[model samples]
Structure formats: structure tokens, C-alpha cells
Target: MKIGKIPPDVLERLVFNRRGAPRREVLVGPAIGEDAAIIDLGGYYLAIHTDPISGSIKLLGYLAVYVPTNDIAVRGIPPMWLSIALLFPPETDETLLDEVTKQIDLAAREVNVAIVGGHTEVTSAVGRPVAIATAIGVGRRYISTSGAKPGDVVFMTKSAGQETASILATDFENEALKKGINKEVLDRAKELAKAVSVLREALALADLATSMHDPTEGGIANGLAEIAYASGVSIEVDPSKVIVYREVEELCSAFGIDPLETLSSGVLLATLPPDSVQEAEERLKKLGIPYSQIGRVTPVATSL
Candidate 1:
């Protein structure tokens, strides 16, 4: 209903209830924690995720590619191809288009993903440029965001407010500076955007992860809640274990935004078996990825 993703309850009641007939090939359809739609394709499964870049304009193309790509990666598969769409306001100029396209191309190349096809139009109906992408991948074995068990441990990779801090700093540098956030800190915040993709951490812990989720629109809290909802369990998260940046805190405080509830794209939430935690931690450590065991899944509460 707001600027970010639709709340889970509303989506379940209105959208999820209206999804068409069920099919045998549809392994994973629309759900709360499930990131991508998985379709059985004989020997392997096809994972697809789609998202739009609507909140920020600084890195339009980069965000468009990475947002959905992060979803696909959490499925324990490398994104192979993407279908992108670009919608620009009628007043948009050729130079803006060039920069967006260039960014898209470079970001796709960096991830070794191909831009298959999409649509582009300059429409007056939109007020700004919006880029959307659908990422597709195939894998033999994959983890769903709904697979967490009751006793599984929950971990969050990287920090909170990663995308939020970066977007605010980059899009509102002057405003942030005026808010008493140091220039150097703002510059560092801008660099956090590059860490938005959790492909490496996702892949490293894929085998050990029973469930994995990308904290995008609703930050770490909502992401964990989605996992708990999807798995039919409750998560006991320790807020003290969450990594929060000072810059993010200050900027969010200045704007009256709750850092924990803000958008955080780079962070990954994972649920793993108790026995597999060691291996998962080892792999992440070897890869130089930071993670924290912030919570544990509990049995779902029921009415007496």
C-alpha cells in the first residue's frame, strides 16, 4: 500500500487467493517467503524472480538488475538471463537513456548474465524513469525461503540498512550533509550500494541453508517475518545481534525513518540446520562475508 512492497496479509488475501489454477509443473508459485517462482522442467527447475526499481534514481540500471537477481541467487542458483523493461517520462532526454542502458549493460556483464529482451517506452503516464527486470536461472537442487524448520538457526549476512543508507546518501547528498552526517560517511554509504548483491554468500551457504531470503523492501525484520510466516514457525530475533551502521542510523533518524523497517537490499537472511551452522560459517568466513546468527525459529503459536 505504501511506497515499498505490499504487506503480506493484503497480498495473501487479495493476490495469492486469486492466482489461477494450480499446475503440476509449478513447483513454487506466489507465496510470502518464496523469492522466485520455481517450475519443474524435467531434469532441473527453472527459478524466476522479477522486481522493479522505483524508490531510487541514482543507480537505476544497477538496482534493476541486482534486485531480482538477488532473489534468484537466494534460490541457490546463478542468474543466467534477464528480461528488462525501461519506462521513462515523456520529458526524458537521449543522454539519460544512454546512461541507463550503459549501466544495465555493465551490471549484467559483471554478473555474467545476458539481457534477453524487454520493452522501452517514453510515456507521460509515469513521472520518472523506472526499470524492471525478471531474472531466470536453472538448478538441480535449490532451497526455498519457506523451508526453514522450527529449530533452525537464522543468520543475516552483511549489515542492516545497506541499500537504505546508500540510496539516501547518493540521492540526497546535500540533505544528508545538512542533517549532520559527515561527508566521508556519506561517501562510504554510497559505496555500500556495490554490496547490494548477495550472490556470493547465497551460493556459499546454499547447500547448508534450509531457507534464504533477501531483505529488500521491509528490511531485516519483515524479511524474517516472511520466512516465519511461510515456514509456519515463529522466529526469535535478537535486535542486538543485527548490524546497523551509524550513518544509516543518523540519516534514518533525521528523516524519521526506522532503519530496521527501511529497505535493505544487500543483506541476506538464512535459516540452517544446527548441524550445518559450522560449515555455513566456515564457507562465509573463507569468502570474507560477515554474518550473524540473529535468531532461531520456534514452533508456531496456536490458540488454546
Candidate 2:
């Protein structure tokens, strides 16, 4: 078992195959690469995403909200509500709980989402605090990860490993410092964590994108592979064109972690029809979000 996500084979063989029952309302249930589940809501589609914060403690509350919310946003929807659960170690105190709640409150307020309901408790089963969130959003029209068409252009927002770099610097500061990662570099990586949410950018390109996915757990390479797998299309990504920050490279090199397979919560991977590429680029530019054309969708499924 890995610290990140369950491997695809295990999910397919054990979980996906044993889903309890079939429902007419579930337009999208469990599937590889599809982050949020969509359900028919009469006039609109309800997109739901549930994710947990496990690896880093630096911004646990904040990450809890954004990580799951990112999935809903990529489905062409803005997360308007959330239900959260916070689990704390037995030795944790009230002050720490209050601070975490404060953090969650602040982030929820910033995104205009209400913390509708949730539970909090201290348990001896866990060593540290972990936050889990289930975000709900509604969209009139939504895009799917499996909608990528052949000849569609693949695109990415921001650099890969933004979350991984930030977490490494904050959680393993001593190790990073010993490895000659400068104070300024570490600070920059920490700062990058605040910009993890892709709600605004996702909304901007929602209409133009044929498919969208947030690269978490498995990073950019896996994210691209998912797009290909879900859509049944082959992706040819130019490794050189995929942006990997120097700081990320240095940090990952020092830690012996694969940045491409690490947790990357902020980056968005999208595919667009050739005719809509110009509009997508323009919208991203207008939003001041840096983007790059990594590759194109091919007719045949191939290696990432």
C-alpha cells in the first residue's frame, strides 16, 4: 500500500467491480481519472468530490478544502458548499483544534463556500491530525475527463509539483536545508502553496475545455496518463514543454522523490478541440494564469 492513492489495478479489481448498486441519477460514479462524481439534479448536475489531507501538516485545513474543491472546479463548477471532518491525535489540545477550525473557516470564507456540516474528534488511532472534506457544487453543463477527442490539444496550468515542493520545504526543512536548498528557495516554495486552488482558472476555461483533471497524488505524468485512459485517446506530451520549476527539481533531487509522481494539488490538465485552443489560451492569459501546450491527443492509445 502506498501513502498517496490506491493503485489503478486494485481499484478496478476490488472497488470498481463491487459497487453496491446501480442508480439512474448517477451520471458519473467511480472511475479512474474522474475526480468528481456527477449526479443528475433536474435543472443542473451536482458535482461532488471527497478527499483527505494526509501527507503534510503545514496547511492541513487549507489543503483539505482546496484539494477536494479543485476536483469540483475542474468539472466546470464552483464549489459552493462543503462538509468537513477533522480527526486529531489523543494528545492534541483545544488551541490546536481552534486554530485548525479557524484555518478552515478562513479558507471557506475566501472561496464563498459554506461549511454546512461536519464532525470533529480526537482519536488515539492516528498520530497526527487529518482533515477530510466533501465538496458539492452545481453546474448547468459539465465536462468529463473521458471527453477528450482525438486531435484535441493538451494543456497544463502552472508548474508541476507545486504542492510537493511546498510540503517538502515546510515539513522537511532541516533535511532540505542540509541539502543546500537556500532559505529564499524554501520560502518561495512555501509561498507557492497559497496559490494551489484552480477555481478561477477552471471557470475561465470551463466552456472551452473538452476534458479537465487536477493532477494530485500521481503528479503531472500520471495526470496526463489518466486523461488518455479516461478518454480512450493517446497523448504525446513533450517532456521539455512540461514546466518543472528548478526549485522543485532541486528539492526532489535532494529528497529522492519523483516530482512527476508526487502529490501536486494545484496544477490542472486540460484538453481542448483544436478550434477552441485559441479561446482557451486567451482566457487563461486574461486570467493571468500561465499555461503551456504540452502535447496533443492522438487517435490511438499509447504510453504517456
Candidate 3:
């Protein structure tokens, strides 16, 4: 198993295929690109998503809250509540616990989400602290990652690999400096962490987007691939149009990781009707959110 997301084939055979009986209320279940599980509650829909923060130790608490909530946001709903499970090793100190809790508290408040309930434990089952968060929200209308259709235009908010750069800068600062990455560049990259939340942008574009996805573990390329696979569409992306921040590129270059394939939680990928592109662009600009028109969705190729 890789360090990041499970391989698609493995997931289908071991996870997706084994899902229990279906229900009418489950509007959206597990799928390649779907961000959250949506359940119909009479007139409204409930969106729920869970994510674990295990990649970067320094940002575990912050990432745990934002990552899962980002999933709900991409579904066009504000995450109203969160349940976080904190797992720490037996030797962990009280100060570490306080720090992580404070981080979670601040992050949840920033997104206006309430931490209703959760569990905390110290055991030998884990070597490092891990924070898992599940976010829930309600909305009348929601978007799915599989809603993209042919002729729709693909758009991306923020830049690629922003989270990855921040992680490397914060968690692997010494390594980055040894690779000749300057302190100033690394500092700039660290600041990119604040941009990880796409809640505002996702909500702003919710009405306009046919589909939306929070590109996390796989960066923009993998995110696009998931959208194409889930929607049964083909996406033609212009590499030149994909925005990669200069600091992100520098850190990624030093680390020898593809910016397009690294974990990118800050970026939001969306598809919209060609006619709605103008409105979407205008909305993003008005909100002062940077974005790019990266490609178009097309029909999947078929043999003659």
C-alpha cells in the first residue's frame, strides 16, 4: 500500500465492492471522485465526510479539521458540525494534547463549525498523534464530483500543491534548506498553509458548478483523473493553464516531487457549463479568489 490514498483497483475490489446493502436515502456513496456521502432527509440533504491527518505531524490538527470540511464545502454546503478523534501514543505529553486541541478549536471556529463531540485516547496502537475529523452539513442542493458533463469547462481555484509545499516547508525545513531552498522561499511556502481552506470559494461557485472536488492526496492531476473517471468523461487539460505557485514549484523541485501529483488540499477543481464560465469567473474575481480555466470535459473515447 502506498503512503497516500489507496490504489483505485484495490479500493474497488476490497472496499467499494464490499459496501453493504444500498438504501434510498444514500444519495451519494463511496466513489472514485465523490467527496462526501450525501443522505436525503426529506426536503434537505445531509453531507458527511471523514478524513485523517497522518502525513504531516506539524499540521495534523489544522489539516484534520480543514480537509474533511473541505469535502462538505465542495458539495456546496457549509460544514456545520465536526467530530474529531484524537489518537496519541502512550508517551505523549499533556502539552502536545493541549496544542493539538487548541489548533482544532481555532480551525473549527475559523470555518464556523462546532465541534460537537469526539473521542481522545492514548495508546501504543499508534506511534504519532493522528487526528480524524468527520464533518456534517445540510443543504437543499448539493454537487457531486461525478456531475461533470461533456462540453463543460474545467476550472481550478488557488494553485496546485499549495498544501504539499507548506507541509514540506514546515515538517521538513532542514531537508529543504539542505537542498538549497532559501529560508525566505521556505517561509513563503509555509504561509501557503493559510490558503488551504476552499470553503469560501466552493460556496461562492456552488450554484455555478456542475461538479466540484477538493484535490487533496493526489494534487490536481489525480483530482482531474478522478473527476473524469467518476463522470465517465474525458478531460483535456492545458498544462500551461495550470497554476503552480513559484514557492510551491521551488519546494517541489528541491524535494523531487511532482507538484501536480503531490497532496494539494487548497485547490478546488470544478466543472461548469460553458455558458456559465463568465459568471463563475466574475464571482471568483469579486471574492478576490485566484482561479484558472484549465480545460474542457469531453465525451469518453469509444472504439468505432
Q: In candidate 2, which residue ranges exceed 4 Å CA deviation?
A: 301-304
Ranking by TM-score: 3, 1, 2
Per-residue CA lDDT of model 2 for 35-133, tens digit only, reads 899999998999998998877776887888888889999999999999998999998888878777887888888777899998898899789999889
Q: Backbone collision count in every prediction? A: 0, 0, 0
User: Roughly what TM-score does model 1 have, to 2 decimal places?
Assistant: 0.96
lDDT of 1 by residue, 1-304 (tens): 5766787789989999998888999988998878999999998989998898878877888888888999999999999999998999989999989988887898888788899999999998789899889999999978898898989999998878889888899888899888888888888888888888889899888889899999888898889888988888899999999988787787788778888888889899999999999999899899998899998999998899
Candidate 1: C-alpha lDDT: 0.89
TM-score of each: 0.96, 0.96, 0.97
Error of 2 at 18 (Å): 2.1
The digit string of per-residue lDDT tens for model 3 on 40-103 reads 9999999999888888878888898889999999999989999999999999999988888888
